[model samples]
Target: MPLITLQNVDYGVGGPLLLDDAQLSIEAGERIALIGRNGAGKSTLLKLIAGELQPDDGEVRREGGVRVARLEQEVPQQAHGQVFDVVAGGLGELGAWLAEHHRLSHAQPLDEAALAAVHARIDQANGWDAQRWVEETLTRLELDGEAAFAGLSGGMKRRVLLARALVSRPDVLLLDEPTNHLDVPSIEWLEGFLKRWAAPGGATALVFVTHDRRFLRALATRIVEIDRGALSSWPGDWDNYLRRREERLHAEAQENARFDRLLAQEEVWIRQGIKARRTRDEGRVRRLKAMRAERAARREQVGNVRMAFADAEQSGRKVIEARAVGFAYPGQPQVVRDFSTVVMRGDRVGLIGANGSGKTTLLRLLLGELAPTSGEVRRGTQLQIAYFDQLRATLREDWNALENVAEGRDFVEVGGRQKHAIGYLQDFLFTPERARAPITRLSGGERNRLLLAKLFAQPSNLLVMDEPTNDLDVETLELLEDLLADYPGTLLLVSHDRDFLDRVVTSTLVMEGEGRVGEYVGGYSDWLRQAAPAAYGASSAARESAPREPAPKPAASPRRKLSYKDARELERLPARIEALEAEVAALTEQMSDPDFYQRGGDAVQAHGAQLARAQAELEAAYARWMELESQGS
Candidate 1:
């Protein structure tokens, strides 16, 4: 059954239409992902569905008795209230019922039987172990153990809001940017919870809006793309939607090319006919009119932002290096300790950690904006740096886009060279009219893109960007990714956008608490694997020792399933084989040197031959890995 329906919804504030005659429907068991650029009315559309805002000229219908719950990114705080009180506020009628039961039980004249019945009702009103469930949810979001609701950070506050929404157990769940400001584990937990909540026979139907690519890939059953104030449904996840969108764009481009060629031919014919003054000149004019109409029909203009980073000159070998780095705030204890990393030329490094884990502070220390209390910060010669902070306060509110880029100052070089402001803003996808708008009037996404444009245009070889993808539109993100992928300079980016990190950075610099930096091979997934043992898996004492190395030759074969222990053993097989091969090689050299017979008895000779045979067998066994990899790939 359709849970909520919007019919010809037109939402606007005063002057411009935000969403124009948009229609959308939600049904039971459907997981819909709402994606669009920031300020493109995604939040407004959610508000419309929640009935928090009235459409200008449309009707919204909800199924009778359908309870919907919405989670806002900015959770409201109440004065003179405890943490449990606000979290329990979403219980509504159930809370009222429980309170009534408590009142009756506390009465002095209450009968024993009635008291017992009221106690049972109270327990039933709350879910099974409801108090424990609430506590667990709060703890998972890192809101417990000295982190109270009023004392929480922005990211922790978002988690508390999510807990409040989930505790209600509503029929429809409306989550706006749930993955925003959440750590990887929290995101994974939320994904699992959402999936379980939207399972068959569950009350909730999830409508999740997020920019996290992994969350979208894991939770979305269908994608609803909101472009230009309109919504279109796609069959699968974000990856599939991207593929289909690319194909559609390619087809449109081809059609435009074909139409352009035909129009060019028609233009030549019209020109030739006018020169010759042919008998069919009137028909030729009609044909030209028809050609103009066809061309008008084929010409389509889509509004999109284009941004690219400016090139940087080569820097020295040691771009940045820190030794015995230690940092702490004024009142708090040390956060980063003895952290050391070498960022040379052509290194794209990612910085990953949970919220309040000093990732940003570490970047600041590397940039030399904040000095470490007891360590040395070293940098190579002629190293230029550009920083992209999430707050995007670099832009001046009073100034226009062009003037903001110019920074309200002009300097002429010795040769009288000058730079124009409008040309620079235009490079960052701003037109003359847009460049004229005050910076305060620009949207969050527009401001973020503008900041990026300015950062890239500057003469910088080493870039230190912190949460660069926070408010950027998807188009700007892709463009930035492309530019960074091709960039020859060193990048030390701290971002939560997994797709962007994977596509742009080469290595990740993890800032775990206690001022330790652990280097892991590969990308984000690799770092996750290395960190998983500590964060999710068992203790190191339970792990097996390193195994022997493997031989090199293999062709192809079939794979066989292995149990947990068997898999572990299989991992060691190659290393064991390599060790045996090395031993065999050493024995062969010793035998040729005529020292083997003199140093040992017949047992040594027999042992050497047996070792050679065992090594060959192990090599053969290790060769099966190629087939397994092929199959897995």
Candidate 2:
């Protein structure tokens, strides 16, 4: 039997059905990737499985006593407390008691009676195990229990939420846009952790909704998509799902075309008054009526998002150049240090770093929006730059989608051609009615589309985008990737999406922290092959062993010839790299144990140093592997 089953589920919100007679079964040890367009009931389905929402007209059955936990998409604005208490809060009422007990015990003036009462309730509920589980979860995720939740970075906060869900010891875990605000490093850590959490015989099932292609490709064993109030399961990897989904869509189209043709014929026959009223044709008329009803009730597939970039004017061969650029706030460590890069015309460069590592600041510095604290930035002439802000600051909240795209005008120029604002918005999949809806009425994906519409309405020679992939569906992301890949302009992009970076950018600038940015010759995956262990969340070690590739000079370079011995070494590098990764993993696992920190600060520091050294060695090995692969005799 499946762990959970939804039988003939019918759910809607007074509009067209979001879920109509949907059936699903979730089994143990399966990592299911739930995908659908925005406002397509993906989150609602998650809520149904989490038992947070009931199906309006169907049975949602869970295996008896099966525990399920969910991590919400957005970090709660009001969630404030020590990390431990917040994690414990997931335990429901017993957790509440324990949190209260901890709070009372830590009060400046000890409230003896209150503390005693709360402690009594904890004991009565046998909550000591729950308390221990919370501590263990925090240790496993390396979260500081006493640390203020609000003080943590976005990635750290996500880990805390994961900890909260894990503390419940749930048999099923549901994550909504788990990578929404995470940095690349944090995302890597999450992938590793969740893989372990749902390993075979781990007694847990994983289901998550995400637009992060890399994340989906890494984890999902099955793909479940919700479309037109129906659920379809594709059992395989992402590539397989893509192929099958295409075939299914094509088959549906053919069937619809056949139905339409027959309906047209029947309409013509029915209009033949004498033949239609004849007794022999009476049954044919009834069939025709049924067919008409069927066609009327048919749900048409949503249209694909149509996007076109305005043609860009040519810029100087040297788009932007920096001479030993650096930026820092007073008294704070450098956010970017000695960062110099030369981006020529049509060079697509990606910026990568942790959440606060200053990718955006680096973009600003390169674009000459902000003067570097220490060096100079030079801009090429005739650079008409179009910036896509990650914060969506370019949009007005009070305005509708149409108004956002067109501040006051009815028509906007694109690629030297004028387009009515509503027509352009329709190209982005926004309907006429939806275009008039307020900005708040738009979903995250819709808002992102609006931002894209704004960015593409003007001509530019340089396109600077920061985290533009967030909240985008996979189809739309792929389309944007194709556009960027073909764009004939200097492109400076800052994104944590590994796949997006790999597919679009020609080069990468990695922020190795402490303001040191290293330029590499390829995208995120290329950088990873040259710096994998570090990409897996070992920033300290990565920094220590980071390659010394500076901003590339535009000159023809010859490749090194690979000898027979070099070829042999290249063949052996994979095993060597794997062994080094194993060592790093072992060290990471040892350090994750709660007792590792319990021993002593000195012991913890020593182990940490050991881990860092191992990671540095791993980084060097990966760099060497890539280097060897690049060499030719």
Candidate 3:
């Protein structure tokens, strides 16, 4: 039997039904990705399953003793306390006792009596198991139990919330947009944690809604989609689902076309007035009326956002140049250290780092918006810039979307053509009504779309976007990717969407840590492959060293004999090889230790990756060394 089943559920509020007799079953060990466009009822369905909301008509059946837990999309602003106490809140009454005990025990003036009473309650309730589970979950998610919850970054807070959910050890876990603010590493860690949390053959189940294509691809075993107030299940990975969904949509369209043709014929026949009424069969007339009703009730698939950039004159060949650029705030550590690069026209560069890393700072430095504490930043001539701020600070939240886009003008110029502001907004899937609505009335996705419409309307030779992919639907993201790929301008993008990075960026600049940044030739996946040699550090701790990050690893050009690049490669190989050997030896020693195995699968896998990377790097180093030696001879 399934852990949870929704049978012919109907739900909505005031408007069209968000769930029209939707049925779904979440089985054991299935990793289901609940996917849909913005406001397509994905979160609503999760609420229904989580029992946080009730269906207007129909049953949301759960197994008698089964447990369900959910990690909400947004981190609670009010969640304040030690990480342990907040996570303990996942458990009900017993958790309150544990939390009280923890609080009383930790009080500056230890309240022995209150602590004793809470401890007695915990013992009576058999809360020791819950205590242990909380600790284990915190450790698993790399959360510090004693740390302040409010002090954590957005990504870290998400992990803490996830830990709270996992502490319950529920039969089913529901996550909504779990990867929203997470960096690539954190996302990868979450993916691994979820896979380990459940089994492929029905041990524990997971249902999540996410816009991160890479995360969805990595974790989802099955896909559940909401469209036109209906639910459909697709069994397979993302690629498989895409192919099948395309075919399904194509068939649906063809069938709709045939039905419309018949409906049109019926309408024409009915328009014959007295002649048709005299011969019309009662059944035929009834069928015509039913078709009209069906057509009226039919909900069409939402249209894709039609995005286009306003045309601008080409920028100078070198869009931006930074020479030994360094920046730091007063009484703070360096946010950028000796970073140098030339951003040429038409070069699309992606900036990636952990949540707190200084991608935004680097962007400002490159754009010359902020003067570097040291070094020089120069911009080329005729630099028309269009910036998409991740914070959406450019948006006028108090104003309506149409006013925000058009300001006082009745029409906005896009791609060298004049278009009415409302009509242009419609191109981005915003109806005239929605366009006229205040910005605050739009959902996160809609706000993002409106921001895009406004951003793209500005003519530019360079586009700088920071975290623009957040809260955007996959279709819009893909559309943006398409637009960027064909764009003829210098682009600097800071985004954590790994798939988006891979699909759109031509190069990457990653902040390793401690103000050190490394540039790579390709996107996030490429960075992973290229950074496999563990350039940042042997371990996470060592990555924070305060040194100017090494320049991009040098590559040798094709030559009959030893070239200057070949000599440079030869010079670096011994040290590279030596470092790899040391890493391998250290990893090997750590793995041999009996205690290493007790750290769990995460540690073991990490060490395995380290060793594998070391060996691969060693092998490559040796190959280059031998080739250089031969060339010298």
Candidate 4:
């Protein structure tokens, strides 16, 4: 039976309909991904499924005794006290009982009945080990349990919320953009955890809304899209869903065109009046009226996202050059060390690392925002840089969308010509009505679109964007990808979206913690392939030079003689080689699993190290075996 079902749901807030007759059924162990354009009601549907919101019409049904946990896009405002307490509070009844039990245990005269009642409540809720589970979840999320919730950073607080949801282990998990504040490592870990939680025979069901293509590809077993006030479902991963959705849309467009032609003919017939006495066909008129109403009720299809970047002025051949650059904050350890690289004109470089791995610091160093403790940075004389900050800090809350984009200018320069601010806003799909709306009234994706529109209006030779993909809808993301592909400028990007990196960046700079940065020749997948242990082997020249030597001539004696140590070593070599080979094979198999790389951080590093050690040991064993065999050849 499906865990949750939505039947003919009609939901809205007295405005235009957001969801019209939408239907959905979520079953056990189904990892569903919800996708659509911004303001298309994806989050609203999730809220309905989570029981946080009621539909205006129709019924939302759930199986008996089912539980749901939701990770909202916005963190709760009232979460206080210790982090442990905040997370444990998600347990509901058991958490309250535990708190009461703790208080009663310390009373001046302890009440046995009160303690017994609390224990019974805990047992009934199956939360006897809730504390242990909370601790484990906190550790997995890399959060300190003893820390105060109020003292944590925004990102840290989001992680804590995630921990709480995970510890609850609800029957259905509904996540809305859970990857927004997560670093690459944390995202990978989340992927692995979700994969494991929803594996075959698992009871958990996952339904999440995300813009991360790779994450969707890794975890989604079914794809659900809300478009034009309707719901569509596909049983596949992201790639399959993409192909199917395209085909479906094409078919829909064709059908709509045919319907429009027939409707036009009907309208012409209705316009021509017939003599009522001779040819009175009231039924036909009524049918035509019904058709016209149906056509009018159909939602107007929105046009594709149109983005055009102004051509940037040509700069010198060398855009930026860094020589042995290093940086350290006051009274802190060095965060960037000896990072030397040359960024030539027209180069698209992607910077990637963990949360505190100095990606931003390195970017600042290159932009000359901060002076390096050592070495030098040289910028071309003609270089002009345009930056897109992730935080969207440049946007003014007090201004409307039009004012924000215009930045107090009536006419802005684009493509060497003056363009009206309202006209420019129209290019980004903002209507005049919406343009006048306050920035605070816009959704996250809309705000991101405003930022992008502002950024692309400027003409610069070098463009540096930090996490530009964050909070962007899928359609806008694709448009941005197309825009960047056609951009004729040097691009430097820091983003955690693997698919975006693969699509836009030609090369990558990986910041492996502790100030070590390595340059690679391709995208994220290319880097992963090149960095794998299997890719590490002797070069072609080394392989040719290390061919086995011809076997030595047999000794005169009937049996080959050897020292005691040599005989013992020969005896042990076969088993040792076998063991090492088995170990290498096991590690290789583990790495082949998609979840292996998604595990990230120490888990991946440990496996890589183990595989390397096993390979080395195997090589040594083979060498000894070759020597032993050559002695009696």
> TM per model?
0.70, 0.84, 0.83, 0.79
The residue-level lDDT of candidate 4 at 9 comes to 95
Candidate 2 error regions (>4 Å)? 107-109, 273-280, 531-633
Model 4, 559-582: lDDT tens digits are: 476677887888889999999989
Candidate 2 lDDT at 67 equals 96
Order the numbered candidates by lDDT, best leading.
2, 3, 4, 1
**TM-score of candidate 3 versus the correct structure, residues matched by position:** 0.83
Error of 4 at 188 (Å): 0.9
The list of candidate 1 runs beyond 4 A from truth reads 10-21, 73-81, 89-147, 254-304, 310-313, 328-333, 409-420, 426-433, 530-633
Prediction 4 global C-alpha lDDT: 0.79
What's the count of clashing pairs in each model shown?
Answer: 7, 4, 0, 0
What candidate 4 gets wrong by more than 4 Å, as runs, is 93-129, 139-143, 150-156, 273-280, 415-418, 532-633
Off by over 4 Å in 3: 273-276, 533-633
lDDT of all predictions: 0.68, 0.84, 0.83, 0.79
> How does model 1 fare in lDDT?
0.68
Candidate 3, 231-259: lDDT as tens digits:
88775368867987899899999999999
